[model samples]
Target: MISVQGLTKTYGGFRAVDDVSFVAAPGRVTGFLGPNGAGKSTTMRMMTGLTVPTSGRATIGGHAYRDIPNPGRHVGVLLDASAQHAGRTGREVLALGAGVLDLPRSRVDEMLETVSLTRQEARRRVKDYSLGMRQRLGIAHALLGDPEVLVLDEPANGLDPAGIHWMRTLLTDYARRGGTVLLSSHLLHEVEVIADDLVVIGQGRIVAQGTKTELLQSTGTVVRAVDDAALERALAEAGISSVASPDGARRTEAEARQVGEAAAHHGVVLLELRAADGAGLEELFLTLTSQTQREGAAA
Candidate 1:
């Protein structure tokens, strides 16, 4: 298991990561999510000991990452797919990693096959590899040691739909075999499909963290009426607070029965009323991190 407790990092007056705490349990895949500049990468760096934290701690199996012997054999990490040496071939890259971990050279061939990199491609220099191919090579190196824990950042950044499907299957199977996986990605739909738990960060702090079901469960009721202004007024008069959704519907924490009764008492005609349970991960993510997103910056 990976435990991050009050992990924080600051640069001068700026707090890159602030009081972040979450656990990636064994036999589960935890999806780390945040908008641009919300400190997702910073938190991951702290967890892997790539950056020093101003306070708190991150540990794997009750030991700090740097303190673990032959860490690659226990914790697989792929923070940057493109950070490999440009002068080396894909096969050479994995070979060096295997040597560092004291793994057998044959492990390199097995990992190349595991990630579906053709032998011909492996013979080419990493500088000639496309972004998608680099991603595959990086994954291969991360898995070469058959570690119990995996921490990957944006592993699907350059994959096609089929490649994305393959990655999803691979990670899910790893977790099924009792390996811990902590994945960070901008692909919300894919995360929704495979992640068992979610940790959402905004402004360098954790905004939400829980099992997928608990986080995605309906938080309120959604209702629409012929007269939106009148419905709003009715709800206000009934002491129920609501927010208008993009579809001209109002979502409130009040139950459906309460909303319907309020509309009826106000002599308002209701067009639709239901539990607001259909919001998917994209909607929830946007809603949770809307304020943290930069105005005109690319994520």
Candidate 2:
């Protein structure tokens, strides 16, 4: 299991990660989610000891990442697939990692095969590999030691549909075999399909964390009307508060039926109404982090 307790990182006066805490339990896939500049990468870096935290700690199996001798054997990490040396072959890259981990050279070949890289492909220089191929190579390197925990950042960045499906199956099987998996991604749909638990971050802090079902059930409802002003007034008069959404307004207390009744009672024309229970992850993420987005400067 991976545990993060009050982990924080600061640069100058900026807080890159602020007292973030979450656990990636064994036999489960935890999706680390956030928008651009939400500090997902910073948190992952702290967990791996790649970046020292200003406070708190991240541990694997009760030991800090730096204190774990032969850490690759306990935790596999793939923070940047493109960080590999461009001149080296995929096989060479895995071979170096195996040497560092003191694993037999045969393990390198095993990992290459495990990641579906053909012998020919493994021999080619990394500079010539496609982004998907590089991602595959990176995953193979991470798994070469057969670690109990896996931390991957944007593993599906360049994958096609088939490759993405393969990754889903691979990670799912790994978790089933008792491995802890923490996958970070901005793609809500992909994470929704595979993650058992979710840790959502915004502005360097955790905004939500729970099982997929628990989080989805917590979202209220979405409603719209022909006259949005009238619908808003009706909802207000009925004591149900709502928040603005792209399509309309969403409420945490009222269900679609309740909102529809209010609209009818107030003589407001109802155009759209739906319970947000088990709503798409995209909707949940957008709603949860609406105010935390780093808006680009106007051109």
Best candidate, lDDT: 1
* Cα-based lDDT for every prediction: 0.91, 0.88
| Lowest lDDT block of 10, candidate 2 | 290-299
Cα lDDT of model 1 by residue, 170-247, tens digit: 999999999999999999999999999999999999988999999898876889999998998898799876666777
- Give the per-residue lDDT digits (tens) of candidate 2, residues 223-273: 767877788779879877665666565544467778888888999987667
Query: Would you give me the overall lDDT of model 2?
Result: 0.88
Which residue ranges in model 2 land beyond 4 Å of their true spot? 225-275, 294-299
Against the hidden reference, what TM-scores do the models get?
0.86, 0.86
